[model samples]
Target: MSQHAVLDNNTHRDLRVRIEPNADLGDAIMSCVTVPAEFRQVQAHFPILFHKNQANGAFNAIALFGFENGENLFLEGGKWDALYRPLALSIQPFLIGRSADGDGPGQVHIDMDHARTGDANGVRLFDEGGQATPYLEDIASRLGLLDAGYRASEAFFAALRQHELLEPLTLEIELDDGAKRSLVGFHIIDEERLRALDAATLGELHEAGYLMPIFMALASLSHITELVARKNRREAHG
Candidate 1:
């Protein structure tokens, strides 16, 4: 269970958040959420794809960590090897809360049960004078970015659906030990359909700032091979 409360100086004066380096620190089950706003950066390191939420039938973009569940191949020696880290993972133990009006600016809330949160030792949430610390400010900023990025992604994903550009992907990967892995049930942009889009449609997507992310997502597919290699390395070293 999570104990979330709107962060304030009065209640959480002595609160401290530990920044741990363990791969399992974050809820990274081989895939982590990635917003369209960071697709350009996420693409360079991880393969970007869309996952379907079974309950709501909604799609969410994700940066894959490994071919199998609970396997984060990017983790080595308690460090992430990738050049880019997903914002979703970085904003740990903190989540954006809904406004009182159900819109406008969000409230910053913390998961008190998270292993990183405690009053003992770490970055303090507030100074003795009741002002936000640099650490808290940074968390708020990143949390805001994540909220905005998620909103922006809704329209971008809708555009992809409207143009019939999203396609199911199934990867057949071979391991270093001659074992084969089948990865399925994820979605990626269809390059052929994207190329076949009319010039007018392309212009509209470009004007809406969705073109760059689309291309970036398409480019990120190449990183699947890198994921395979990383898995193989883990298999060999473990």
Candidate 2:
């Protein structure tokens, strides 16, 4: 359950949010939606994949954190091992909420029931002068980026589909002990198709600002080997 309320300095003056990396704060997911704007940074730390939304039939880019449900390999000892975390995960406990009429500008909404809220030693949301603290300001900025990125993602996915660049991905992993695990229901960029594109098509994609992210997503696949290594170490320790 969640209790959401529009953030106000007067009402939430003493509210402090714990910003540490922890699984209890709802970071235990195997993956989360990502955006093209984050692919450059996210690709360095996690594999970028595409997931088809069953309800909407839309494709969303995701940052893969684990191979199975309820697993996040990057999270260990209450700390995220990656050098960069995706904006979707970092902007937790706070979301941009539209007004009642739905035509007004977005407002910052905090989840009051979140584990990060009301921590005694957490970062303050407001200062003594009833002003938003630096922490809240940063969250607001990230929220803006996430909002804009989501909007831009539609064009990105359309470009991929128009060019038929997405392909199903099947991962068959063999652990050190000869145990096999298979992960399905994910899609990735088709490098062959990308390379086969004509100069005119490539130019169009470059002009539209989707080329870099495509390459970044391709580069991110290398990190899958690292994820397997992490899984091996964890199981060996156990």
The numbered model that scores best in lDDT is: 2
- The Cα error of candidate 2 at residue 133, in Å, is 0.9
Any runs in candidate 1 off by more than 4 Å, and if so which?
99-101
lDDT agreement with native, every candidate? 0.87, 0.93
- Candidate 1 residue-wise lDDT, 75-113, digit = tens: 788877877778888888899999667787799999998
Give the lowest summed-lDDT range of ten residues in model 2.
98-107
Write model 2 residue lDDT over 55-138, tens digit each, in one string.
987999999999889899999888989898889889888998996776778899999999988999899999999988888899
Using all chains and alpha carbons, the TM-scores for the candidates as numbered come to 0.94, 0.96
Q: Which ten residues in a row have the lowest lDDT in candidate 1?
A: 20-29
Error of 2 at 192 (Å): 1.0
After TM-score superposition, the amount by which residue 95's alpha carbon in candidate 1 deviates from its true location, in angstroms, is 0.6
